[model samples]
Target chain A: MPTPILVVDDSVMARKMLIKALPAGWDVEITQAGNGVEALAAYRAGKAEVMFLDLTMPELDGYGVLETLQAEGLNSFVIVVSADIQPLARERVKQLGALAFVKKPVDPAQIEAILREYGIAL
Target chain B: MNDQLLLTPDQRDALQEVTNIAMGQAGAQLAQILEVFVQLSVPRINITESSSIATSILQLVGTPQSVTAVRQAFSGTLRGEAMVVYDQNGCRDLADLMGYEDDIDRDSERELLLDVGNVLVGACLNGIAELLGAKLSFSAPTIMAEDVEVGRLINPQQLTWNYALLVEVHFTLEVRDFTCHLMTLMPEESIVALKSALDAFMENL
Candidate 1:
């Protein structure tokens, strides 16, 4: 089975854009969680090698989810996704061990670049 | 300070013109992102005391039992507040257009609100900044329900003026069958500068 990647965000629009941006033939199952709480539960249930997490949420936001994952010592390949292009959010997420940062209105080219950089064949 | 000093008649006219162009650009940006045609009427401008702004803006967005509003502040030669208000139901409709699944929870709602706010407000500010030949920065958008009193939310002290120039923009999302509005408020001083800038640009052309 290909790596199980988790997609975390509250917005359906954001998730749709993420799916569209993913390279074709990734050969992976994408599971989605609406908020940090759901994402934390998803992480605890199974190991997802990769996650695309949104930063701002009402319950267990992106940062909270990252912290939860870290506390459990799960070393998933995580990426921080947000519409707020503030550098502070980026630096904070990077410190939390997110593998990458993707801005919304997700561009296919950027997704491809991240995939290439991470050496994931999709 | 006399609040009237903040804007001359020419300045008011210039700000109106700028807002007209800005709304058009915002409409175009939305259409491009949604991959559908959008129709946005030229915005109407008014200068009124700050006390009445919230009621006026709310009326334009329509009376919904629940509304989700996104606000961002920008500063430059012109400093002001910009808000995009939509019915929460409208947001879900937008989510559907963006391809979100049928079920959307609270967390997803927040994310959707942020994305919606980002694109719409970002595009609006970007257009205005470009037109004014200035750089703009925005704080993270906060989403609130209809119960939130918008007028009270705007700090009177921050305004430093008794009156504000309000720009009301009405727009339609063709695919989604929803209408939204963007309201922009700026200090009288900013209006003065904008007018001078517009007049200068016009003379140059």
Candidate 2:
């Protein structure tokens, strides 16, 4: 069975960039959410095993999603992708149980490396 | 101004670090959108009377006969107004680089100004908010003035605060010979919240 991946961000441009960065020939189904509320809904529906989350959005944000996931004990792997590249941001996301943090404008190599580190085979 | 000294060295340093990262992100986004290399200045942070913002901006960009400016206000956990200013020549040069025809008119120039403002100001504020772990919403960009002194563009009476915390950064496009300034003005009430937010961010680090 293909792995299910959820990409969440308020920016259409950012979401498209994340999708384009996925490794070639990866057998995965991709789901996209424009904000954290949608992301949580998708998560609840078992639509994603992995998520790429952005920190700032309209409704719930990346941190809110992480908090919700932790409160509910959801075990989905999360990799935060955001333009906010401050050291504090990285630390907070790590503390929130994110698998990794990647800065924006998304780099395909970085995404591949992160997926590899998480043992997601290309 | 005594109020300018409200931030301790450590707090100022932390704010500067956040501003630098935000400016970098904004520059990267602008570069991608315009297909040009954007050179950014070190961000400068200052607290001053709200009335002095225009004077400070003039000191940085010099007094020009005509200029184009865009302002957007943001509110949420952090609240501020961000403005982008460019001299007439700078705006013309930028429009040319963006593929505007040789005879660009006032309407086209205004459109160009707002488009750049939306990209740069929006990204920079979002970057800052992200760093502080706050969410912000921005008003639509408004063209404040054209063909006027930079200092005269802002109306003191309209500002909601007596004191302002200013985060300023400059961007230069060498290839296009265009330069512009971005200024974010956080009110005194907002600065209190910002300072606490900075402290929290630093403690976590």
Candidate 3:
């Protein structure tokens, strides 16, 4: 079965860039959400075995999604993808249980390396 | 876009996303400087007539109020001016953030605002230029207007351009009351360069 993935962000362009950056060979089923609210709904709908999330968004943000996931003990692997690259932001996301953080203007090779480091099954 | 805007909706969206990433870097710099989380809004781009920019600005500032604004001109693959506007209370909050609690005088307050304008505007413009793979140089930021009504912030006669593309974003302090509107106004000539730069960036992605 292909790994289910969720890419969430308010910007259509951002979502598109992220999708393009995904490992080309990874057998994945991709789902997208415009904000944290939609992301949670999609996750509950089983479309997010692994989630790539953006921080600043309308309706609900990435931090809210991470907090919700932690509160509910949902262990769907989450990798935060955001333009907010502050060290404190990174630390907070890590503390909130994000598996990793990737800065925006997503790099394909970086995404692949991160996936590999996490030992994600492609 | 009465002039039959050169930018399509798709292009506008792409530019806004690019501006978002750039502003994010600027916000992070602020957060680091003040030791407070900075709240960044989604970047909004508007193509407006220079004759009516004041109206757009008044709408942005919301309800006429005394404000301070700083302006810095930049030149490169893109050329334009960056303006940072703050309400009086926001200026006070920024002063408080910098520990200027001892009854800041007029000159001191203006200086403080200019310093902040440099920090936020410089980082944001630099980030955009870097992302677009363009070289940009900025003149020193100067106080454009202080303690003026939003409607009087910019004189139409002083404007050199007929049409401008304004990229606007807001940054708010998470715990403090500081909020500022950062706007980069690109004139007709600069808009052509910006569109091509934006196109090149989108192409790479």
Q: Report the lDDT tens digits of candidate 2 across residue range B1-205.
A: 5554488777786776677668878887777767776765656887878778667666667654567789898999978889898887888788888888888898888988999998888888888789889999999998988777777777778888888888888888758768888888888778889989888876765
Per-residue lDDT for A29-107 in model 2, tens only?
A: 8999988999999999888799999886668888899999988986998999875655656788899899999986678
Q: Name the DockQ score for candidate 1.
A: 0.01
For residues B1-205, write the lDDT of model 3, one tens digit per residue. 5444578776898888888898889998888778898888888888888898999888776789999899999998888899999988988888788888769887888898898889988889888888888999999999998889989998878889888888889998889777899998878988878888878878887
Q: List TM-score per model, in order.
A: 0.54, 0.62, 0.95
How do the residues A30-108 of candidate 1 rate in per-residue lDDT, one tens digit apiece? 8998778988888777746788887755577888887877777857889787753545556778888888888654678
Q: lDDT of each model, Cα atoms only?
A: 0.68, 0.81, 0.88
Scored by lDDT, the top model is: 3
Off by over 4 Å in 1: A1-122, B1-14, B62-65, B144-160
lDDT of 1 by residue, B49-160 (tens): 7777666665565553456677777776777877777764677787777777888777786787677667777776676667667677777777644435444445555556
Question: What's the residue-level lDDT of B20 in candidate 1?
Answer: 47
Q: Candidate 3, B197: how far from true, in Å?
A: 1.5
In candidate 2, which residue pairs get closer than 3 Å at backbone N, Cα or C atoms, i.e. clash? Answer: none
Error of 3 at A120 (Å): 1.4
* True lDDT of residue B153, candidate 3: 90
